[model samples]
Target: MQDMIFDNNQVLAVGSEPFLSRFDLNGKILSRMPCAPQSAFSVSLHPSGVTAIGGYGGLVDVISQVRSHYCTFRCSRT
Candidate 1:
């Protein structure tokens, strides 16, 4: 795993093929998302209740962290 963070009693891990995993405080994985062919190497949680996911070929996926309220945008470093 490249990195991980604990939020709201949930542990989020990122790395390798298991690009991301959501685990409870008890260490049981609740959900998971494998990396694509592009390969993700970095992730960040934003204070605006959003997550920024990045990968090869300058790919990025930004999603709202809020459950009830969320949004998406197609943005890149270019």
Candidate 2:
């Protein structure tokens, strides 16, 4: 799951699957992505309307407020 700060009201949760999941303004799930398996982990949201998602083996994906995307260095410990 990915945590997103939308419209400054509450947090929005989007699934890690390739498809998109829908949620109401009240943070209720109106719909969900079709059952697709994807490797995803914890999610953190910033006040700047950015989202950070950690994936398996410690890969981090970042989504910017401008709708751009980036990936950060991965760190892991066994």
Candidate 3:
């Protein structure tokens, strides 16, 4: 079994075989994803401008980070 989502809170469910169905806003099965294949276990959305995401494969995905451009001076013997 797999979980599917149509609108913000609405959800459409199906088995592993894969099929087609439609529904309305009241927890009804509307359309399907682009491929209409397997369903994702979980999904999330992140805002733009400096963000991070982690995966099961020990991978840390990042968008941006703070940077410094200051210079340092060094003294030498005469």
Candidate 4:
């Protein structure tokens, strides 16, 4: 795991294995999502609750404002 951030009553993580995982405030795993780069290493959240996932591959995924579920986002550069 490279980096993590908290947002929207949940913890978001990006790393090698789980790729992306969401955890509750109590530290229980909520759900696991697939990372585009597969080897994502960093993550951040926008004010709108959108998650920005960054990988060593110089790619970034901007997840939509996720509430109960992370529907989708567009991928771009580092």
On TM-score, the leading prediction is 4
What TM-scores do the predictions have? Answer: 0.64, 0.53, 0.26, 0.72
Which residue runs does candidate 2 get wrong by more than 4 Å?
1-11, 14-22, 26-37
Q: What ranking emerges by TM-score with the best candidate at the front?
A: 4, 1, 2, 3
Give the C-alpha miss distance for residue 13 in model 1, angstroms. 1.4
Q: Global lDDT of each model? A: 0.62, 0.53, 0.34, 0.72
* lDDT digits (tens) for residues 1-78 of candidate 2: 654434454444545664224466766775443222254545566888676666555666676665456545477786
lDDT of 2 at 8: 54
Q: Is candidate 1 or candidate 3 better by lDDT?
A: 1
lDDT (0-100) at residue 74 of candidate 2?
74
Output the better candidate (1/4) by lDDT.
Answer: 4
For candidate 2, what's the RMSD?
5.0
Which of candidates 2 and 4 reaches a greater lDDT?
4
Q: Put down candidate 1 lDDT per residue, 1-78, tens digits, no spaces.
A: 666777788887666652557789999989775543145667777777676656665555565564322333334665
Q: For candidate 4, what is the total of clashing residue pairs?
A: 0
Model 4: residues with Cα > 4 Å off, grouped in runs: 67-78
